[model samples]
Target: MKNKLLKITTNLWFDTQAEEAARFYTSIFENSKIGRTTYYGKAGREIHGMSEETVMTIEFELEGQTFVALNGGPHFKFTEAISFIIHCESQEDVDYYWEKLSQGGDEKAQACGWLKDQFGVSWQIIPENITDMINDTDPDRSARVMTALYQMKKIDINTLKLAYNE
Candidate 1:
């Protein structure tokens, strides 16, 4: 079978951190790599005000998904309204991702398995079966799991399991 190209790709804006952010993200995820990198030149100099040869965009891949990090300047900032979700299959997976992504991140933004990374990007490191647990047919079980989840910053699979069982 031929490899299909992704129709929709995520574009991340950064103020001079496109290369840095892409490198950091690729290092944390398996099967990830840095691809093509574009640089600024005399074109659009009046509007961009960027030095010639400065990084313009960096293309990278993480777990088969393509992403482009652009050095779009400080015209915008990242917000919690848009966030990425990292679905984990095991407690170890959850812990690893949480720790790696949360390093040097905003402590106050962490809650219910959500964190704002140092790059100001929001991420939710949650269990792969979180939807199943929270959408259980039994309302009481689902409520219990939600309560346990709300009390956590980094999701604890064991605690969620206990709540689901109770």
Candidate 2:
């Protein structure tokens, strides 16, 4: 049977590191893999400025989500406006992702569980039960959780729990 196309797939634009980024992402996530890769040809040399046979696009998957990394040149860059969130069940899980994703990243951009990775991609490392805490019927408890959340960078689950209970 043929594979069905995903209704929605994320496409990342890179100056020239599509393949590299794909490799890095796949390596970090389990059940991830690098898929097909297409190279540039002389057909669009004038517009793209990339040489023939250079990597044009790379297809990759992270935890089953499909993404395409395009070497579309320096016309664009990643920004904090778009970020992938990783929900963790424990502090250990949060810590692991925070450490790995934040390596060689912008330290100054770290705030409220959001971080920009080395590839300039923003990511949110948060607790799995964050929604429940924030959706509590008691506004005071939810407000407390938000207050505690704002003061964190990597997101301490224990602290959030404490705030919610108080």
Candidate 3:
């Protein structure tokens, strides 16, 4: 068989709970689906030292990004260096994702609408206009917006605009 090129894939390591995490992620996203669940067993077993019913790997897609979750049994934990940033158009959108991701997890709001979810995933629920404010032609306005963003956990666009005008 010829090897065919495919889409981008990110592998996530979990401690015997990859399937569970995949399900949770699929549930949260709108355009998402579970692709395959591979188990261990038999001579053609996909996973080593595991039974046929044991979850070995899971394939899932979120917003068109493919990801594989491997149940490697907790050799590692998620760190803050890599994270998913969600751009929000409004406060409602921000609240929805923030509430859902923060479930059963810790929360730390960073300046400029960035937050760390319970799973140690960093997310930025920034407003659409943030870019415009930051890239404003007026240096004073841009500086003000930057200052406002530095003091906020969840960005408020109106407040940012007001600051930019100052």
Native-to-model Cα distance after best TM-score fit, residue 91 in candidate 3, in Å: 1.5
Sorted on TM-score, best first, the list reads 1, 2, 3
TM-score of each: 0.96, 0.95, 0.79
Give the C-alpha lDDT of model 3: 0.77
Which segments of candidate 3 are over 4 A away from where they belong?
1-6, 42-52, 109-111
- Tens digits of lDDT, candidate 2, 1-166: 4797647889999999899899989888888999999999989788889999999999999988999999998889899999999988899999989998999999999998999999899999988999999999999999999999989888999999999988
lDDT of 2 at 161: 91
Instruction: Give the best candidate by lDDT.
Output: 1
lDDT of every model, 2 decimals? 0.96, 0.93, 0.77
Candidate 2 contains a number of clashing pairs equal to 0
Error of 1 at 29 (Å): 0.3
Please list the Cα RMSD from the true structure of every candidate, rounded to 1 decimal place: 2.5, 2.6, 3.7
Off by over 4 Å in 1: 1-6
Compose the digit string of candidate 1's lDDT tens values, residues 15-84: 9999999999999999899999999999999999899999999999999999999999999999999999
Q: Which stretches of candidate 2 lie over 4 Å from their true place?
A: 1-6
Residue-level lDDT of model 3, residues 1-166, one tens digit each, is 4698755789987767888888888898899999999875585555444556778799999898899988776568877677777777787887787677767665454546766655555667777778888998999999999998898877777788789877
Worst 10 residues of 1 by lDDT: 1-10
What RMSD does model 3 have? 3.7
